[model samples]
Target: METHDSLLARIAPAPGQCSRTILDPATGTPVGEAPVHTVEDLEAAVAAAAAAQPAWAALGHDARSAALLKAADAVERSAEELARLLSREQGKPLNGPNARFEVGACAAWLRATATTPLDPETVVDDGETRAELHYRPIGVVGAIGPWNWPMMITTWQIAPALRMGNTVVVKPSEYTPLSVLALTAVINEELPEGLLTVISGGPDVGEALASHPAIGKVMFTGSTATGKAIIRSSADTVKRLTLELGGNDAGIVLPDADPKAIAQDLFWGAFINTGQTCAALKRLYVHDSLYDAVCEELAAVAAAMPMGNGLDENNVLGPLQNQQQYDILARLVDAARDAGARILLGGNPDPGQPGNFYPTTLVADIDNNNPLVTEEQFGPALPIIRYTTIDQAIAMANALDVGLGASVWSPDVSAAREVAARLQAGTVWINKHGAVDPRIPFGGAKQSGYGLEFGTEGLKALGQPQIINGWTATQTRATPN
Candidate 1:
């Protein structure tokens, strides 16, 4: 029930603190001021987290789970305010799979992370010896989040770390700090002081957070370049890392797929969040037999989705989050046009537009090696490549150094599974793309990044594993000569 101004005021920086004005991506207007914390601030946060860790871990699993449940309720109570703030700051509309969906996902992941069990397991149990494996708290964890889904990704990083009994210090992206600050404020209502904190600073602060000696682990979701930088910084400390980096995911369409039947799903797969998703389908490969038909169907679906300011309820799609991203998308689309690729729809934008609004573009008859197809556009431009054989499609798909996700679309489930098996991605969807689940483990292969998040595997990643081995009292030990 909080009003927009009241919610913004709650997360505003203190009167004298150094801060930066966050701009609305849909319109070049100030959303709110995010406090610019420095390396000193990061040190204090980490110190506090390190100091608070042992007591939190001693509370045991049930108490922590109960606290997380209350935090989830807190998120629900402030859901509307968080969604509206996210829409303004991140440039995703309130409708569709944008702001509201991201906020709802935050609460869902909290509840899921709270209840998922990780009981001690007896790895080896013979009559003579028994060995059990258990996970212990890693103390302090540092979380670095990206801008595209700021609030939800923050939840993804923090929930498991807290559930595993580690205190977390978050460093949100410079582009979307207000959303994260507001979100953590809501969740912190039910959490103890110093249990969770957000440091909204520049790259220097991020570097400090990753390399700080007090932090035992770091969970990051950002570019491959930043992920590599984090690895180098953490080398001295040998911090445990969970990195979800950049991905130029691909999707393959079999000749048997019905173009009209799957067009809607295909459109959303590539254009979700204006195509800012890390695991979104960027390059699509369709069999030559149905290439033209698939392109036409997808183009028809893309042309109908409304794009405007995020405050507008009817506009499901919004502007690119920043001008740099908009320029990257425009340059790639223009290069495709110069290469004589067929533009099925939307390759141009009005220069007079107020915000960074690039049109939804679909390029067909494009070569597999074209930059738009080869590189990660990270926008609402999809390059469709045609292939005569499944092997050729699979080869192009696997050729990329980064493989986070991919999909195979076919009417026959069995056939789709066969094609999917040949893909080198971390997750291969049979008839869809980027349908991440809280219960299923998600990560990347190759240069896309390392480690896993979500489910039981995710919980284990946040903690340190220990083995307890002992001999049974009934067993008699033999003497060695």
Candidate 2:
């Protein structure tokens, strides 16, 4: 089959056609284009992954480890080029922590999954009989990733699948297809054919991939609405699934917290990646004692932030991925202000800036009933609500349906730990925010979606348990007697 030249690829295809374009969010230019795969393309990719899985699974741990290590090397070598493309495609900070952190996640996850063995062991060892357990690879895995974390999240899905000896078919978000392809290209150079594959396109392709009969499992990271849709579509086949969905992660600023520290943590937690992160901080509940100080500190930082194209080295804030988000963010801010919330610092679009970039907007006095409080604003806006008591603060924080992640701001370690225990979330940080570990599981509870990614949990997510009957020669002799 002939492949189209990358330069001539179309962004969006005509109705049924499989084509797409990559928008440079910085200047509103066509950065690049790639094929928008169709339902048929989804079928083909699924078929390819299904057919390739058995052989890949048979390779055992050592061979797979070598491939993963090679892929890690490739990623490290291409980090610069990948970061540039990611920054342009995703409109993130030019060579800053976000891009570098993503690349580091890829390297870390791949190497860790490959090197760490998901060893199956013997369960019972009686004198008469023994039972041993073994893990077999689940068949083809369908991975649907999100735009907020196109590259790193995909690696979380793909690396573990490969490590567990499974083949993968990835469906990346349309907005940031280039980074996924770039990552895939690196893997293709290191791994064998069909071990990993990528299909980029729109919603139909995603539905097709989700419903494909050959796909044994699906690991999805997107919104709760779409995760529900995926669950419904795959109900007929009963495909094994792991969904890491939406989040309205709240941060609790205790009476004992420092204002300046809370302000800086709040800035990065909410404003990082222009607030296009699922786990980004959206809600803040502050104790009345420190509420005024926290508000002032957050506004002081927000006022100092410089918004510009991600390509600019000096830029700290970049564009929101699309126009709908731009409008929604602005509207949310306005609604919060209209609903009696105090506008501490930011509340509008920066008229002088190019692209869909918005300033780091901060609002205060928002209540749980407000839409800004309930919904996930995937932008650089943080709503701070004051609470008179710790009980009131916890109550307000738990009001949202999403329980993806939460952070507690307190100078007291014991208090932070106590709060972290009761908070309804998959992961919670104490006195620190957005801290993640590769060796630990990362995911959410409630409407945030079920299942985990990374570490031993990720490997377990891709395996099937089996009992092997065994008996030593002496045990067999004794049983005969």
Task: List model 1 lDDT by residue over 293-391, tens digit each.
Answer: 999999999999999999899998999999999999999999999999999889999998899899899999999999999889999999999999999
lDDT of 2 at 428: 93
lDDT of 2 at 143: 92
Among all windows of ten consecutive residues in candidate 1, which has the lowest summed lDDT? Answer: 1-10
lDDT of 2 by residue, 1-481 (tens): 1121231232233465555667877778876666677777778877888888888889898998889999999888877667667777888876445676788778888898888767778688877678888878999999999887688989989998888889999999988887888788877789888778888878998998888888889999988999999999999999999999999998898888899977777788877777888888888888888888888988898888787777688877778878788888888888888889887776767677778877777888777778787878889888887889888878878877789999998879899889888899999987666667768899898999998887887788888778888777775344553
Q: Please tell me which predicted candidate would have the highest TM-score against the true structure.
A: 1
All candidates' TM-scores? Answer: 0.99, 0.93
Residue ranges of candidate 1 with Cα displaced over 4 Å: 476-481
- Root mean square deviation (Cα) for candidate 1: 1.1
Question: After aligning candidate 1 to the native by TM-score, how far in Å is the CA of 17 from where it should be?
Answer: 0.8
